[model samples]
Target: MWRRRAPLATACAAGEASLFVNGIDPGYSGDTAVYGALSLVTRADSILVQEVCDYGNYDDFDFTGTSMGFGLTRDDEPPPLFLPGVIISMFGGLVRNIAGHVGVELDEMRQRIEPWYTDERIECAMATIEPGQLAAVRFAAVGVCGGVPVITVEHVTRLTAAAAPHWPYPPDGHIGVHRVVVEGEPRVEVNTHVSHPVFDPTDAGCISTAARAVNTIDWVCRAPSGLFAVADIPPTELIRGVMW
Candidate 1:
């Protein structure tokens, strides 16, 4: 069910970059979905210095790519019956057919726009960030419904830290004593989770290229609900889990 297609890239004079991608969910009746996205922010003024170092350079941009498509559900075959069973089967088949058509059109659009963005242009568009500042990147997804496309979702993540609170006990009545204590900044971890309509781990070439482009910050693509566990698990358990 996988298609041999490359990501479609585009940039605007206003310093915006874009990438359109297509992936198929083989497990779900080979249903294909398209993900059209704006380019990730990469300027030194937009990303944290520590995060930039994590990627080895200020240009190493991390992004949460998203896509949207119909939530196709696979229906179970029903017993052979009269009009009721026939109607159910027909409706299910019709829905799948419509989804398939949308997928094809999306793929065609991606292919048509491929030439607009070249390798050199894409590299030049990725900006860099400075140290100690929080990253200023944003994430959004394009969705198609009834043959029309629209912006369906948007997200943003921020990194922050606060001083640890202190507690003191009162002096005993027998002895007069006073004590005060101050604590350093409390360490906090920031996590950004993004969900896409479809993902294919087998796309080694695409994944490798993206990882390198972002300077390899351990990007993960998992099931829609899998991200919830990231907050509960330790760093060692933050393993990559993909749902196709």
Candidate 2:
């Protein structure tokens, strides 16, 4: 079996080089992607980054069914990711990073949860849904600046692609995408559609997250020894160190 341990070795004391990586979310979307969108507009109102995907294609029954509570009913409490303090602890840094970039002092961080329940039973790659079970969920982490929600990170996860009809989605209605939407004059929406020839949308998300670390390795190695935010270093001009 493939095995791994945390990469604890670093050149901090020597201070010759560094390695920094953030596995997805506020790091990739908030720190890096949103900044690109903000660069396009002079006047900004609010910013949103969303990962919209149908987990049914992920093919991991245990993860989606138990860990994510995808097939859970109202009687069951929400997953740990949605529990109090989880989103904040996980995403608060991204919010603060964006706030710092935008020159706003955050008043507070807020959380919002919306669940979509299904009336009929359904089967998918991840879990078998029962009547009254959750078909989709929307979770948002908001950064309030000057009494306004200036920055937001949202997840729109569904058992099937059609679960959350009213929520934001990719223009092509694909299964997996990272969407960055800046609400401003000359507003821009950047949708990064993720796919793999071998894996489905869910597995492709896992692959894409892992790729962030690989793709940015060169840029990170040459920097001063420290942790990194997405804005700290720009990526190379093109893909590198991979064989076709």
Candidate 3:
């Protein structure tokens, strides 16, 4: 993809700039936030970042019920997002970005998929999920080194809390969260929660996503031109105000 955008890099080299940002999954869920907790990294055998979200209050039917395949039954065709290699296609950059910073040359990429079905009807905020429908899923995109997994991005998402009772839960037992775990280094963990007084987790996520993009504009414009990771850019002052 970057190969096709060679001109963007060239423009950046000529003093123009470009910035790529995303929401919770490839955004705070892994790349930048995952790198922030490396100070305690005595030894990192494996680094895992997770997003555990309960979409019960998220009212976007197109996203939750459709895009994520939350209301589909076992017999229904899998959503395009859940098709083979789709996880890697979506999150491989996140794995590669972290690997590039950790100085690990990944040998291959792999994905783990576990789609859970709802045993009973679910009255979700976005749509109704009948029994046997795909109500939750836990999927991971892993980057390997020497045939061992080194960096991974996982998501355990459900339309409602009752869908995947056996799967991984949020660190704070909340409706939404992003958790990062470094297994070998003191077992350090970082959990980020974004919530609003008036909005649901879905809307909160959307707001924070745009906030990330807006806040990074200055850094991106000042940095050198090229495709880069969060670590590649120079540090700047960060402000958190109530302006939002």
Candidate 4:
């Protein structure tokens, strides 16, 4: 069957830039298309646009529900945004040209998300309780798109407490927070937003101090796992995958 390749090409062109399909039909049976697609990486900052980006009929083996794995290619390291699905609405949005940049509008592009985790309001799911000798805290995770709330993570738990050795004074330091629980153990939940991209090294020191103060509170506890892995809303430099 001579399947349609225009749909795939269209989807690719609607994004950050346009992709030349080299006049190949995606329906052609075999892995040749896959190789041809992979070979496009030599170009500068290009992605391997999957013509039929959806999961195959094999439902059990198909990871389409949680991760599309669309085979995005970049010249540098990839973006840190963990996208589990494709943005269906993006196909209908207005396409903009940001100077030399192509694809969708800047504001509209920010709205695209694949959902790494569900959204749960930390205000409701989490609480800090200082019980005399010990301190207990809980946090909630929410999936956000373009600054808007979408899903909530009510089941998972992730918590981090600022550590000692005091990060550093200038721009040459990295601070780590403790999880308050043993590795591979169930834990309490905690929710808090992190302000990343400190821009200046001096400012980073102040933030690190603030983090340490939070952890020093008697006994601050948190969830052992979940979305609280890398803090929250990190800078583009700190992120590795395609951020919604």
lDDT of 4 at 148: 43
RMSD of each: 24.7, 4.9, 2.5, 23.6
lDDT of 1 by residue, 11-40 (tens): 221323322221111111111111100112
| Model 2: per-residue Cα lDDT at residue 149 | 92
- The positional error of residue 49 in candidate 3, measured at the CA in angstroms, is 0.8
lDDT tens digits, residue span 131-221, model 4:
1211111222233335543222111112112211121111212221111111112222111222257443223434543543343222212
Candidate 1 lDDT for residue 97: 37
3 against 4, candidate with superior TM-score: 3
TM-score of each predicted structure versus truth: 0.17, 0.85, 0.88, 0.14
Error of 3 at 155 (Å): 0.7
- For residues 76-179, could you state the per-residue lDDT of candidate 2 as single tens digits? 87787668877777676677777788887888999888888888877887777888888888888899978899888888888876576787666675877788
How should the candidates be ordered by TM-score, best one leading? 3, 2, 1, 4
State each model's CA lDDT, in order.
0.21, 0.74, 0.78, 0.23
Best by lDDT: 3
Model 4 segments beyond 4 Å from truth? 1-19, 22-94, 97-108, 112-244
Candidates sorted on lDDT, descending: 3, 2, 4, 1
Local accuracy of candidate 3 as per-residue lDDT tens digits, 1-244: 5774687778766865665555567776686678777767788888988888897777877865686788787788888778889999888888887888788899999999888888899996777888888888888999999889999998888877888898877765678888888887578888988888997767888898877666666666666566655555544522233257
Question: What TM-score should be assigned to candidate 1?
Answer: 0.17
Name the better of 1 and 3 by lDDT. Answer: 3
- Weakest ten-residue segment in model 2 by summed lDDT: 1-10
RMSD of 4: 23.6
Tell me which of candidates 2 and 3 scores higher on lDDT: 3
Mark the regions of model 1 whose C-alpha exceeds 4 Å error after superposition. Answer: 1-134, 146-155, 159-244
Q: How many backbone clashes does candidate 4 have?
A: 19
Please give the clash total of every predicted structure, in order: 11, 0, 0, 19
